[model samples]
Structure formats: structure tokens, C-alpha cells
Target: MEPVNDIAQLVVNGLMSGAILAVPAIAFSLIFAVLQVSNFSVAAHIALGAYAAYVVNTVLGLPIVAAVAIAFVAAGVVGVASDHLALKPLRRHGPITVAIASMALNLVLENMLRFGFGNTVQALNIPVYRDWVLGGLHIAPQQFYNFLIAAAVMVALFCLLAFTSIGKAMRAVADNPVLADIKGIDPEFISRLAVFIGMGLAGIGGVLIALDAAIEPTVGFRVILPIFAAAVLGGLGNVAGAVAGALLVGVAEELSLLVLPVAYRSAIGFFAIIIALLFFPRGILGKR
Candidate 1:
């Protein structure tokens, strides 16, 4: 392929990957906005979701939709349960305390997954399709479908946030918890709900990644850097910024292949973090 064709294909591939990454990045930022914690345990929830879906999809031979539902529910349940048991008591101490506890919780959950599933790679039971070539650009059907699904989820999320009372309450809490509390909104309830939704989205993100790549205990960890990069690049607590950040990070990572070795792909995430911190402290779409 010509250089132009190569660049076009890279951009398309980047968009596909960016769509998947955005789901979890939004989860991260959404949680941060309301809870003011990093919640690194999100990585474990991603792997947990992938495993849940894998059991239903491969072992029980269920439909992908069923698996996705199970994945969301399982991960959401674990997320809230863990938050309550481990991090909740520490909240009054400080966000940093909770963050550290969350990292410990992350390690515990990931290790639990390792104990249960072992260190083996598993792939989803989806049919493979050849890439479609158009004007010298190749597009994978699975990736394209995943991108559409991601877009739909984002739209539904926007609608929920815009039109639903629960969403409005959530926004209120994110903006000013004290004010929301004064207005009769339940902070504890909102916190639990945010954790559930945020971790559930992370689970969906796991499914998306596993659709094309192998699923394993470390699957989520492998992408945590990029996910964090996306969130930080967009503005840590801004949901909309996550989507934009993900696209830019994805495209930047893919384009790096032109100059850097394939093994150095993950370096883009680090680079993005530095650039975001140095140049755009509030992120590209973040509020000034």
C-alpha cells in the first residue's frame, strides 16, 4: 500500500480501537467526577466482565447479548460490593486514602481472578470475518460492529444523563455533592450507583477487547495504561473529554507504528500522559 493508504488504514483502525477504549475511559472519568477517586480496581472489573461473558458465551453456548448482560451485571455487582466493603470506610479519611485502598483492592481482585481462572488465554466464540477493502483501506467487520455498539452505548448514556431524573441527580452530585445533599439527594446511593455504572461500562469494554484479542487475567491490565491515558488526556473527571481523548490516543498510538517499533506501542500512552500534563493540564475538552 502507498503511504497515504497506510495512514488511512491506521486512522480507521485507531477509530475502531478508540471507540472501545472510550467506554472504560468514560467509566473512569464518571467515577472520578462523582467519587473523586481513581478506582484502579476498575481493571479487575474489566477482566471479571470478560470472564463472565466468556463462561456464558463459550461454556453455556449462550448468545452474545446474554453474555454481555451477564458481564455487566456480574462486574457491577462486584464493583459495588467491593467498594462498600473495602473503600467506603476510608472515604471520610481522604480521596488519597480511598485511592490507595482501591489499588490494593485491584490487586486482590485480579489475584482472585487468577486463582479461579488460572493464567491462560481465552478467546470469545465469535466468528471471524475477513477485512473489507475499500480504496486500499481494510476494515474488520468485528471491529466495525464493536465501534457501532460503542457509539450506541454512548448515545444511550447521553440520553440517560440528559433526560432521566437519576442522571440529573448524578450530575448534581458530580457538580456539587454538598449542594446535591442539601437538595435531598442521597450521596451514598449516588456513589453506589456511580460505581455500578462505571464498573459495568468497564466490563463492556472488556468484552469489546476480548472480541478481537485474547482474554486473560491480565487482559485489562494490558490496556490500563492506554485507558488511563485517555482519561487523563481528556480531563480526568470529564466524561465527554474521555471520548475525545480516546480517539486521539488511539490514533496517536497507531500512527506511532510508522516510526517506532511495534513492541514500543504502549509507550504512546506514557507520552500522551506527559504531553497532557505539560501542555494541557485541564485536557483538550476539559472545562477551563
Candidate 2:
């Protein structure tokens, strides 16, 4: 009975963590699906988003909602800028060139963050720390909130993609940019919009994480690999797959704690990625 309880707790923890991870994973997958470019700078965007929220909360003394809004808008703008100033111009240079450019941008953003915010860790002061206990299981308020918000956002994204004109256009462009353009869809505009949405989602994730845990200049770097693992495991560019992969990775990481040290928990993501690639090269849900 005790062991079963432990397993349940682990599962709960995994679900909570996975909910937080799904946001960025979905965002990363969205960008890749549309642009076919692995934007490594996404991690930087996450950090920037959190920092933007911090500024709004600390410097401006705004409410949490305002901070989150600022973060979302700021990150979305950065995403669009990256696409226009760097990615769009380098389109003809090939994926490798674009990827390298993104890496450079990521470095630049990270350094800028470090210079401006310093290397100290920061936390958001959201006044919600109560937890609910159910069936001998403990659940933090933030954890529940994170799950709810993530789930809501994912559903909203699905609706946007499934039932809206812009969503159809985005999907059309993703399926075949040249064909979409020929059909009167502006591929460039769609690409920018995709990046904007992706970064906006990342910003929301960053803010949630900041509220739940301490954030630092390197916070984005720390989670980027796990998010990538989730994206790859779900089959890159598959939005629904990314969420599924994030949950799996989160559960796997939590379960690994039974045998592995806390410090090495993050290695679980890398292991998952490697194993997935070896057995399922196209990802569990990735279409070849």
C-alpha cells in the first residue's frame, strides 16, 4: 500500500511538471512545423519572457495578470523580430544556416539577459501557495493552476488550428509553403504569425514557471533540452504529440527518481530522446 501511494505521488508530480513543459514543447513544435527551422533561440525567448514579466511585476509593480500579458507580448514581438530580421532573410541559405543563425541569436539573448538581470535567481510573488490534499495525495495550488492553464491553452490552440481561417491557412502553409503561396496564402505572413504564437505560448510557460519556482538568467537554458526532448518524442511539428510526449517525459523523469539522484533527473530527458531516436526515429507520433 505504501509503495502504491508512492507511485501515485510520483505520477502526480509528473503530471504537474509535464503540464509546465507542454507549453514550450508545443510552441517549439509549432514553429518547426511551419518554418521547418529548428529555432534554438526559443530557450532565450522563454528567458526573455520571464524577465519581461519580472520587470512588469517588480519594476512597474503591476499585477500578475499584467505581468503575464507583458511577457506574452514581449516574447511574441521578439519571435516576429527574429523571423523578420534573421530567419526570413536567410530562407534561401538552407536549414543549417538558419539553425546556426538561431543559435547565435540565442547566445546574444542569453548574454543580454545576464548583463541586464545579473546571474541571480528571482521568484515571482504570487499569493497562492495553498495545497489541496486528496486520497493521501498532496497537490500544490500552483501545480493545479499550471495544469489547468496548460490544458486550457492547448485546447484553445487546437481550436485555433481546427476551426479558424487563420488556423487553416497556417496548416496549409505548414503542409506546403509554395503550394500555399500559390493558393493565395502569404507564406511569409503565416510564418511570422506562427512564430508570434509560438513565442507567446513560451512566454506563458515562463511566467507559470516563474510563479511556481525560482527563475534565473539560465532558467531557459536548463529546461530547453527537456522541452526539445518532449518535442522530438512527440514527433516534431505534431502539436498534440508534443503534449503527449511532455507528459510521458515528465512521468518518466519522476519515476526515474526511484533509482536516480535528484541532480540527475534532467538526464532522463536526454535518455528518452536517445532511446526514442534509436527505436522510433520519426518519433512516436511523427509522420514520416
Q: Which has the greatest lDDT?
A: 1
Q: How far does residue 119 in candidate 1 sit from its true spot (Å)?
A: 1.5
Per-residue CA lDDT of model 2 for 131-215, tens digit only, reads 7999999999878987898898899999999999999999998888899999999987898899999998888888878878787
Model 2, residue 137: displacement in angstroms? 0.8
Whole-model lDDT, model 1: 0.91
Model 1 clashing residue pairs (backbone): none
Error of 1 at 206 (Å): 0.7
Q: How close is every model to the real structure, measured as TM-score?
A: 0.97, 0.95
Whole-model lDDT, model 2: 0.89
Q: Can you give the lDDT of residue 91 in candidate 2?
A: 69
Model 1 Cα lDDT, one tens digit per residue, 133-227: 88878999999998987898788878888899999999999989999999999988998999999999999888888888989998888888899
TM-score: model 1 vs. ground truth? 0.97
